[model samples]
Target: MDVATVKKKVIVVMGATGAGKSRLALSLASHFPAVEIINADSMQVYRGLDVLTNKITPAESQGVPNHLLGNIDPSVEFTCKDFRDLAIPIIDDVLSRNRLPIIVGGTNYYIQALVSPYLADDVVEDMAEDSRISRLTDVDLNDINSASAFKLLNEIDPIAANRIHPNDQRKIQHYLSLYSTSGILPSTLFLGDTSRKWGRADNFRYNCCFIWVDAALPLLDRYVNDRVDSMIAAGLLNEVFDIYKPKSDYTRGLKQAIGVREFDEFFRAYFAADSSWVNSLTNDQVSSDDANMFTKPKLSGILNSHDSNTLRALLIEAIDKFKANTRKLLRRQRRRLNRLKSDFGWKMQYIDATKAFQDESDNSWSVWVVEPCVKIVRSFLLEQPGFLSSTGAPYNVLHLTSKDLCTQYVCEACGNRVLRGAHEWEQHRRGRVHKKRASRLNKCQRTFSVDQQAAKSADGELNSTFCNSP
Candidate 1:
């Protein structure tokens, strides 16, 4: 039988960056007899720099076979298509040996493309060919800046734009080019169930269970802060220094990794005796009038005449920026997980990884995490395809997403403050301050997550900010 016709079901463990995805993936491997894990995290695929990528140590893998972890050379550009193209055969091979496949990570885009193999087929191929030219012409994200780019795309294709991150310039450009070339709304093409789009294939083969290991914002925020601190203590700076101590620039793929780029500007300033390196950034001279059109975060600088204490303060600011940006990344990933269920119709079950992580000392891993997930997997194995609830009623994304009562809007676009409730957020969304920021999100911010803790509203416009002018 073709792999698509095979009844082999795979498990996907997805969540924000610090939500214990690797820990839970390992636990599931111990619970199930023949389970292998494939890394779905975009950063972890690159070889070396374990601390920055938060790579799983050998001790943590517990002898469960894991594929695609720290395997790629960092110099090569790795895309979602690269991940999907490489992962499909390995998944089939593992299933052929009667081993269960567990895909785990924070990179939902990688998981989305892997699950929907053809999702990246045209967009990515076109990008590779037009990468530089498109960087200059209409889809040239570098010329437009991400915020204006996001707003323009949102106005044109809100449905497709909903899935993209505002700061994701490449995807924004790809979608723009895709629409310009095909004249089809990317949201319609990617999210629609028609054969003309990318969705559950008519030849849909795999029995898949997507488990979202999530936590409350307070708990998750604490977890992210602590994790960043731990990574730094465990030698993240050393890993960075090994590469940048020799002065490697962004042309190398490793620099694109989150933990590194956040510190890139600061490192250049610290190492150089003069501000000569700033020239490298300004090499592409546009007309002075056009310079203000770009909205990337201004690389703040410490005064050259300032004392050592001032430079130390600048370093501290850089560290804070890294931690803050990491949280924003997790928040974006959380939104993507919800979109997987809401937009693409993926049946994602929720598990409170915080509870599981806290309950480990009580030896409740099997009880809280492994057993619950396995029970669902066993149902699929028994040909109990999960199209409806036990009562034979079809389910909606609202049913899976709406239990938490502490809903609030996190407007990174506004000022990174959590709006007290849905009404306050709706007001803020319509407020002039938010509308201005929403159009050109500062580098520190991406899109706003209004009513982040609540279920989707009836109109399916939960994330909309005011697009109309006053």
Candidate 2:
């Protein structure tokens, strides 16, 4: 087989949470010479919360030279653009050394940023130094009302406006910012260039091999639940407690991890249960106005054993929510991967790890998932025929296109819910809730019409009787 390929080679191991993507990447690393792993998991990039984020241990990495793993500040908001900028250089350096860079993570957007050259935010950032952008005051940029900003975007670029949710102020601001700085319609950026759109598989930066590690949903759900239990045993609660500042922004950074925010209620209740601990706090130790009155160390020493039934119930509920959210994350990851393959023409090699996960042994993983994946990667590197075959799109694919950016649907029956793309609108229209609401609305309209007709008829009869009497 001819081994000719694109300019550079990179491998991406993608999967839902708890699918053993990192393990597979490590296993594959051992099989090849000069291999380096790049972490693409969004939450794992931030320092601390090792247990909650499920970061790979140094022992687990086994000296594979993992880059971008747990080096970021927990408070810093790491964006997709940041990941792309950081990762591109690392990938190039790996390629320079003739070492294979295997990107292992569940963060698909990070992967997309690496593969595709165009990101809307990147373009906007590049235009930040422009005179037009610099002339605007901070207040002017920050003080714009979301509804008005969205309206402005609609007037300027309706296609871009349609793609964003009205409730999503961040995206509205981003688009408006982009247009304001560049003096170009936001829609124009994505109009002709298919590569500029989401999930650009047609124009990739490297000769990429995408390995999607997946399992059956039922099995995956079970695995995630078990994994959450394992996390709890591994001191997930302790890790969360360390960073449990009351009213900490959960929207950004390491705090956005699945396990962190779920524990908010439990922690709040636990802390409030022991008011004695709060009373003992000195003003210097904790601010009088600070909501986080009790430090973790102080709380640990004082109220560790005071596990009331209410606290236990709350803790249990939090644990249940964590597991449920992780399961939801798995579903979302799977859907995104499927969309990447079907809509963007990403030729991903799907390797089912269901049997391997079921057996739950090293030997089982070797036989069922690892060995097969290693062989596939070897074939991919050698440009062999077997690995080149495309696993056709899943039957349930929405068949979305680039024009989806311009597509918008507002469901009046569903409280005028704004849905982007044809597939989403179609799904919304077909949903049981929407159907029920529409039926009820139609019935009410019909009843109103009949009542109006009867009232008019009564008035007409009254007028005729008066005329006849006269």
Best by TM-score: 2
Q: Write the per-residue lDDT of candidate 1 for residues 1-470, one digit (tens) a residue.
A: 58654555788888998887888888777668798999999889999889989998898887888899999998876878788889989999998898899999888778767766356455544445434322223554445666787888888888767664566676777677666655556665543333223433222335577788777777777777888878867767657755664444443356778778667666666656334343433685555334323311122323223556645566677678878988888887886676555544666778875665665453565567767777766775564766332223344534433432125457887667655334346656897878888878743233234444234562345345444434
User: Each prediction's TM-score against the native?
Assistant: 0.66, 0.78
Pairs with steric clashes in candidate 2: none
Please report the candidate that would top lDDT against the real structure. 2
Which 10-residue window in model 1 sums to the lowest lDDT? Answer: 292-301
- lDDT for each residue of candidate 2 in 115-207, tens digit (9 for 90 to 100): 886676655555445534222234364566778777877877787887778876656776676666666566755644443455566567777
State each model's CA lDDT, in order. 0.67, 0.79
Residue 121, candidate 1: Cα error in Å is: 2.5
lDDT of 1: 0.67
* Residue runs of model 1 more than 4 Å from their true location after superposition: 1-6, 123-166, 173-196, 199-205, 245-252, 273-308, 357-362, 384-470
Question: What TM-score does candidate 2 reach?
Answer: 0.78
